[model samples]
Target: MDPLSPVYITGCGAFLPGQPIDNEIMEDHIGRVGGAPSVFGRRALRWNGIARRHYALTPEGRWLHSNASMSAEAVLRALEAAGLGRADLDCLAAATTQGDLLVPGHASAVHGELGGGALELASFQSVCASALMAAKYAWMAVRTGEANCAAACAGEFSSRWFRPEFYEGGALIDTKGRLAMAADFLRFTLSDGAGAVVMESRPRPKGLSLRVQWIDMVSLAGRFDPCMWAGASEQGRAERDGGWSRRGPLAAHAEGAIALQQDFNLLKAVIRAWIGVYLDKVDAGRIDPRAVDHLLCHYSARSLREEIVGLLEATHAMIPEERWFTTLTETGNVGSASIWIMLEALVRSGRVQPGQRILCIVPESGRAMVGFMMLEAVEAVR
Candidate 1:
């Protein structure tokens, strides 16, 4: 990790559909919503307390796509909204586990636009640890005097699926069945969009001060990899070519429910232990351990998010009622873009005010990275 001070977020902007996906109409999409009480109203009220969410997706949320480079366009819009232009940046960077392309990252084109500037181009990816890494790199660059300003952008090029089957490519599930369809299109909770933050050494009049104290990381390699993927095989000529190359959180050719439960338990324990240490470290911007305004985490499934919500409530790290972002219900699993999406929600909801401390816990690669930052509002140009 690059050594840096508690950096500040000077400018912030995001793109979600101007309209929101209100819960009142949720059952219209999910099978579970059908038999649930209030049909739509009660569940909408309980669906993570989210009145509506933004999306850069189609009306059905069944397919995944945007005008190519839509996120880049979002960056332009975000920067303009933040009162920043190519002239004001020091670096252009983006993070993602799932990207449209691997070599030339989403930032390459963004950097290309800032002609004649001294801004460097960088890309960081760690499954779900992307945005934090990108932001950390930016903060370090500013603190080390490497750059006067930087743009830390993050977005997810999510595929249309939720069954956890495609994690290992093989046969495709027919999207015709209700269960199969739900498995494929679960990103409604996530409005595919781009978000950017301008980081600077000198605070501008209308910038958001995102004081990041520290970022800690630990790995449990060979842990969830097995749970999420399998390479077992059958004895056949066809199997020789196709077997042992499969992946997923779904049951393997031979994976049993017991194995699934054990793996799930391990992941849960990993999160609990890390947060235990994180919470014990120090005060989080004068807020009570139990009073944490919200918990922004990587986009996990609905059951997992609820499970974590219970855990946070039990440990008093955050109140259950404060679970504001539910990607499972909307965006499916956003891979690495989950945390940034939640942060955007906070900004849009007007819940994150100057000096409000928010905690973002990113659990990926069988490890967890904890980021605690304090937000200070920036001056906006009329």
Candidate 2:
């Protein structure tokens, strides 16, 4: 393969486990903490605007699929859509917020579940931008002639963390007799799913292909404290004594450190940071806001949509509302898997035409990181 050849995303696949759980019935599945419904769940559900979402668990809160299994299923579907098989891939890249095991990397776990010949592998762990980072790695592998065919995937088994058992006998209520935001916020927002994309040196023989133009990623951790995190106390006490490992496991669990937490106070800063990054990209000539035919943004919640739009317009880097695409309301926030799932849906909608440009933006509030990718839809080389 020529080193100068362009890399194309020939196929995309997404797998959302189990049936769609409606907002009214969510407590029935995940169960109510403290043997009663949370007072904040209804308000949170309304604010997030997520009507339905899928989970990798049954009504009794028993897990039905592991993160690796879901990722493998998506990979198989992507390979099939690309008219290829597992043996055809030369590289596999995977991303997730957390895997089933803390020892082996997520890519290794996915590869083990996929069960094919040996291949190059990479794993990424972060909030929302992890999937795009994995895609960037796969694209580089194909573009640099290091591989002929590559697949990048992201999966989230977030439902496991939201189950009531995780919070059993823990302090979840505040002084007002309501569930604390730190423990209650994510329960209504997150869901479980996986998505994958196949990239190759050449486009498919007879269909639309997304030619990779550029992928840019940046981290602004220096400017912000941890906004979303787990495995540590919300007060940041663990950091002063080395880290979470310094605290005994029982102590950490009793302090509710193992549960996911978000600092809602920092959300505005996070959105502003995302807009600033977009403005920087425009100023550097890396992107033209007006030329973007489609904009897929992973904002994690519908409540932030207006704020993001306002910021974009204020910064003069606005892509019109008509050009925006999102599935947050229907799919909930699947963290790192969201962008890939959105891309797969857009490509399958049959609305894209040759020469169309699709821009993807992923903002991660975990220490404020963001990723942007641009792709041009092209006709396959027949």
- Go through the candidates in order and give each one's C-alpha lDDT: 0.51, 0.88
Best by TM-score: 2
Per-residue alpha-carbon lDDT of model 1 for 1-382, expressed as tens digits? 7554345665566555434556655434332312332222343244333445544444454444441254455556556755677677767777765455535765675565444556687887555666677877777787788887777777664422222333223332222212222122332333355566777765555645555555545454423232221133222112434333354324443332111111343556666655565566434444354445555665355555666667666554564554454444443344555566566666667666665556666766323444444344433323
Query: For model 2, what is the C-alpha lDDT against the true structure?
Result: 0.88
**Model 2 superposed RMSD (Cα):** 1.8
* Residue 326 in model 2: lDDT: 86
Scanning candidate 1 in windows of ten residues, the lowest lDDT window is: 253-262
Give the residue spans of candidate 2 off by over 4 A.
1-3, 173-178, 237-242
How many clashing residue pairs appear in each of the predictions shown? 18, 0
| Cα deviation of 47, candidate 1, in Å | 9.5
How high is the lDDT of residue 186 in model 1?
34
Top lDDT hit: 2
Number of colliding residue pairs in model 1: 18
RMSD of each: 7.6, 1.8
